[model samples]
Target chain A: MPQEASPHIVRSYEGELRRLREMIARMGGLAERQVADSAQALIRRDTDLAAEVVRRDAELDQMEREVEQFCVRLLALRQPMAADLRLIIAAMKISSDLERIGDYARNGAKRAIVVAQQSLISSLNGFERMSELVQENLRSAIDALVEEDAEKADEVWRSDEPIDGIYNGIFRELLTFMMEDPRNITAATHLLFIAKNMERIGDHATNIAERVHFVVRGEQVTADRPKGDDSASAVAGAPR
Target chain B: MPQEASPHIVRSYEGELRRLREMIARMGGLAERQVADSAQALIRRDTDLAAEVVRRDAELDQMEREVEQFCVRLLALRQPMAADLRLIIAAMKISSDLERIGDYARNGAKRAIVVAQQSLISSLNGFERMSELVQENLRSAIDALVEEDAEKADEVWRSDEPIDGIYNGIFRELLTFMMEDPRNITAATHLLFIAKNMERIGDHATNIAERVHFVVRGEQVTADRPKGDDSASAVAGAPR
Candidate 1:
């Protein structure tokens, strides 16, 4: 009779896996909203919105912890093998990456509050553009992972180059602004950091995409990732 | 006879676990050297040393891959339960943290190569002091993990506040320097980034210590980890 009652108990395992996936998707959505809101707060100089972004980061952090515990429980209770194990592991890694992206967005929001007080810079639009691109990549990466669409993940990976390009432009422009006038240094430095933070968010997106690829393909994505951050070289004026 | 095998065969399982521990220790050593060497290169303006640090990052990257694969194989083959399961998971997480530490060091070294060309600032010594503290913490954290010393890991976690204090000092000092003179902006900006990088390295050390605590104690470390980087509020000039 116990063996015959297996169908009812077996459904719970599938339900647990589905619940884990849904939790990750919820986290991704929160992180993406934080990214978009923080950028808007920066561009609009809305200190209130920026403060809200800072407060929302804790939710993602909490979600990441919950996801980690869930994965561990599944591994211990179900003893997942092969593809199932890989899926659980990838979910854990992806949650961490999403949590980090939320942190970056919070950092940007914090910086935005600072820069808002200063006389606004004309070139601040770059932050908006950069954040928008990274947000798109992050959303796509999560979608790819959830759908198991490695091709879409690959697309997200390829789109990172443009984000780097925007970042490099912002870096050079900020450096030039700082060099031209002493007054620009403080705000320019903050802007540079905000730009750098967005770039890092892009990197995290690529990292998530790679995890998706690994889970689906059972192989590492080995292409040399492109980076366009040549600001140091430009600042040093060193010949490569 | 096969079931009642000699002690030699039984020891192999323990040996595999030891090998994994040794691999992590080796990776930690390499990351420590990278952190120390990169900081020295930055402070001393040693281009050759900075270049060397940059080159050595690839080794840590390779080690992370090896450690990951080894952990995956262990999980699949041994099907470790409870404590052993937690240790393997912790090992995977710790290796990734170490690899990120290696990246931060490499970024610092790369910036150092550029900053070397500019006039040196006396306040830059703060970075040296900060890097030393993080290196010590990282070493202790790895030692804790390898030896399963939860007490030592707690010590490392507690040590992070002082590291943050040093970082905050560096941050405020750099800001004042930049505000005082335009000439200080370029080098000060670079120094600010290096200091931030080291601060992040310290945070990663705390993260490792937390993981070690988890593996040994079977419970998450619940203390409010300290942070002293108040640059954002100072820059924002917001009333607390």
Candidate 2:
């Protein structure tokens, strides 16, 4: 009887691992939607959508807690080794990165509400493009996790430079607006932060991809992460 | 003979736990110094020190990886149960938070270098005070982890409000400067991000405290975290 039950136990453990991946995939889906809606709220100046995005962030926080608790329980009960162990650890870390992505989205939504009240500073086309890239990366990263595809994860990791490139352009353009007219300062400043938030969200997506790569390949991505955001060291001349 | 060997094995495991705590404490000390030196660089307009801070951040990233590797080894070797497991997990989580804190400090340092090249906008007294409080909180949180004092962690958790309050003040003041003259926009904007970095560092400290609290008590902090950053929704009128 004990011998017969052993097979069932092994199968159930495998099922639990599958369930864990599903949970993360679900959480990732919600986070991606939050990012999309927050960006939409900004581009369309929809305060209601922004407000909804803010209110919805609590769900991501709660999902993170659930993921953490589930991972801890698995660690305790299964004492999983090798790949299983790495996958569980990766799940915990990925949940954290996703939670932070949700936070950046929520912050952007709040700033959007403020930006909507001011006159348009310039075309928000850059913001739209930036967010679209971020969401695509976020989606691809999560898909790589669920599919256990390290190549896809590496693609997401390598693709973040373009998002940073867009952010730099937005940063310089906003600074030009501020210098062109003081009236643009308030809106431009808030928009700068929102753009920063999107760039950060992209970074988190890259972090998730790196973790997935580690889980599948049992090694860190050896290449230095490419970064294009030079805004930190940027200096603008005074308005003449 | 087997019993005799078992005693030695248990003692060695105990030593490893002690070593883990020491590792985290040392990492925390380094992170605190980075925060302090970054703020000092900003306040004194010391470009060399700011460059040094930027250079030193790689060490924190390496430390976080070491902590994670150690925890994974322990999990695989000892299969630590209950409190031991919790402590190891908390160390992993706290190291990630500390790594993030180090990144914020490094980014602030980079911006400080740029700010140093520009004319002074306003007194950096607020930046000094904010960094001091953040360092204090960071130190207390690490101490709480080492001493297993949940009350100390709780105290650090409650004290983040003041840091946020300082950040909000700096945000408005920077906006006012940008409106007064476009010449101040570049300096003021960098200073604003530096202040925001300090606030974020403080939040990471609080996150560390919360993790420590959970390790000690085996439950989440149930109270809603107090937040004072209203700058997210702030709006400033055109300059007179």
Candidate 3:
């Protein structure tokens, strides 16, 4: 077994770590809310809510840095082992996922900023559905982390397929809207970005779920998900 | 200064790490080319090339896993130090970025799958140009890592704004196309996913650039990009 830090120190660190975990979870919760709110704002053309989501992101940024520093310091000072290593790594990965999710929310807000001004798209149907799926995934992924539930992590992994299907559906539908009316182009374009952003948020949630699985099971569950593989030809100067 | 690992081990490990880095670089290179190829496939409607791009992604996924395993073994046995720690972490981040870039390529290909069947959307005029910018950012981000060029990293960071602008322009144009002609929706939808894929690729490139900066500078540059602020929320939990 790897040599761990002082027991008492580790104990205290555990307490601190729990707090850190909670903070990260809280931050994730806030980001999730932001994404939902932003998506809704886009649907309803609510400028105030969109701007609020944008402003709140700065604070999230500050908190993210702080969390990373804490994780690094814990690594340096405590030399956390095994499950601890997994947790720290999970924190890092989940944080990255959360941050990306925040970007999606903010992007949704920005699109809301632009699209809200003009005529709203009549069918925000798939967009709404996609947003809800992402939110559910985000919630479950974090809950899996909190509970250390490998089962829950697996559930999140399986859920990604349908999310993609929805995104694909939205992609086609939005195209129909954009293709039909030049006047509808501006609003439709913003809506498309919003849909893609929501899809990505679901993807990130899936990523976090992967991390959560790794943390709990000590095996990579992400292998079951879609991963990029066009890299083998890279070594021998093979034609890309 | 941090203590070094066993010299003989370090030397061999260094060689392995170098090889690993190169492999990842090559992977990055491949993923970059695939992005370019898929974009070209979309423009040219080469369905066969798009299919080939999809088939090749499996190899990239395998390489990514290989790099991760190699890094873990080195860390476990070699117990790397500061620059080395940074290097390993950087490799991890780079590999992840490379893998995601590959995903974008597949994404592009998938869109091409649809676009290949339909008549080309006339308004997707600047797509190739926008894709080149995204591809350039991917190339430079990898170069920044290879050369340890902080300035190049910064350059990559700055370059993303224009890609965003192009993406915005594309979104609007596509919307306009759909609005003008209902017949254009099918091709237009495929083109939009392609655009979204390209934009996602650009974001992943920016992620690599950010990771390179972190490796070289040891400072988190997460706050600098003001686009959507996605990374801060999911992982920002405070240590309780």
Candidate 4:
């Protein structure tokens, strides 16, 4: 097991690690909320909520900057080794991923603004379902990071397959909808991009999971990443 | 000006920085080749080449690991200050971006394999153009890193507008083709994703540019990012 720091101090090596964890936890909370709110905004066509998501992304970005500076200072002053070093590095990477998750959420919200201006489609359901899974994976990934639980991280890694499956279904369905009417093309395409963003968010969550596994295990995760992306397997012209 | 290492030794701090730069350069070269080859495979419908791009992604992933390890080692050993520190962190970020670009290329190749089995679209010329631009920007971004030329990086950052414009144009053209014929949806959709990937590659390049600026200036690039994404501005409902 790795040596984890106590969360109750602020001066020594352990205190720094504790602060790092806290910053990451805070960033993760903000990121998770962004994902949830962005999805909710898209589903309800709540442009105001989407705008709020866009505006709040700056907070995550600021948190990322702070985490980076803190990690650098810790690395510089503490010159930690072994698990502590790994933990610090993991903190940097996880913060980057969470910041990116924020960007994806912001991008989704931006698309939501455009999407809301268009006529509605029933297919936002796919987005909602996909975001739910992504949000769950993201929360779990962050929890794993905080708890340093490789098993929880592994579970999140494995859970990406279902999200990919849902994405593929959404991909084909969106194309069909676009083909049915050009009017649906704009909204459908926006939805496609939103789904793609969620898919990427899921990928980043898995990335965090892998990082968590690495920090705890002191080695890279060697298992093949599970993939269920069948959306591009066959051309529409090819025999199924 | 920041102190640069003579690329001749390994036992000194500057030598470590030089080695880090060399690794990043090599990784950047591999990533660039992957992008070029993936686009080539798509254009020629050469599944073998596409497969090669997918296979070669492992090299970039391995390179990313090496770079990460090297950076962490340098940090733990040297505790570099100012430019050196920024450069190391930038290397980590750049490698991650390069790895992601490689993944996008591999994804494009995978889609190209399926696209090969289907009917071809002349609109692929747009993809060719977009990839060329992205490759150019990526090359310039890396060069900016090597030369520590923030001006060049800012230029590359500005250069993304044309790429986005091309992407938007392709988005519309592909949507038009798909709207005209349901049979075109599958291939056009794949092309759309490829275009989006290229757009994202361009974004990554700009991200590198910003990092370059940051590393050289010791501060974040404060200017607003230049964005000309017309993809969401108007629906396909507008007159061609």
Best by TM-score: 2
Of 1 and 4, the candidate ranking higher by TM-score: 1
TM-score of 1: 0.95
Chain A TM-score of each candidate structure, as shown: 0.94, 0.96, 0.88, 0.92
lDDT of 4 by residue, B115-171 (tens): 887787655788888899999999998988888898999999889999999998888
Worst 10 residues of 1 chain A by lDDT: A231-240
The positional error of residue B152 in candidate 3, measured at the CA in angstroms, is 2.6
lDDT of 1 by residue, A185-225 (tens): 66887888888889989999999999888888888889987
lDDT per model vs. reference: 0.85, 0.93, 0.74, 0.87
lDDT of 2 by residue, A33-152 (tens): 999999999999999999999999999999999988888889999999999999999999999999999999999999999899999989999999999999999999999999999999
Against the true chain A, what TM-score does chain A of candidate 1 give? Answer: 0.94
Off by over 4 Å in 4: A1-11, A237-240, B1-11
Give the better candidate number (2 or 4) by TM-score: 2
Off by over 4 Å in 3: A1-6, A123-126, A165-169, A178-180, A226-240, B1-6, B123-125, B220-240
- lDDT minimum window of 10 residues, candidate 4 chain A: A231-240
Could you tell me how far off, in angstroms, the CA of residue B77 lies in candidate 2 after the best superposition? 0.6
Fnat of all models, as shown? 0.40, 0.69, 0.26, 0.55
Tens-place lDDT digits, model 3, residues A108-173? 797788776767657777778878888898899889888989899888888877777776666555
Best by DockQ: 2
Rank candidates, DockQ, best first: 2, 1, 4, 3
List runs of model 1 lying over 4 Å from the truth. A1-5, A236-240, B1-10, B236-240
Over B112-226, each residue of candidate 2 has an lDDT whose tens digit, in order, gives 9999989888998999999999999999999999999999999999999999999988898899999999899889888988888899999999999999999999888999998
For candidate 1, give the lDDT of residue B197. Answer: 88
The TM-scores, one per candidate, come to 0.95, 0.97, 0.84, 0.92
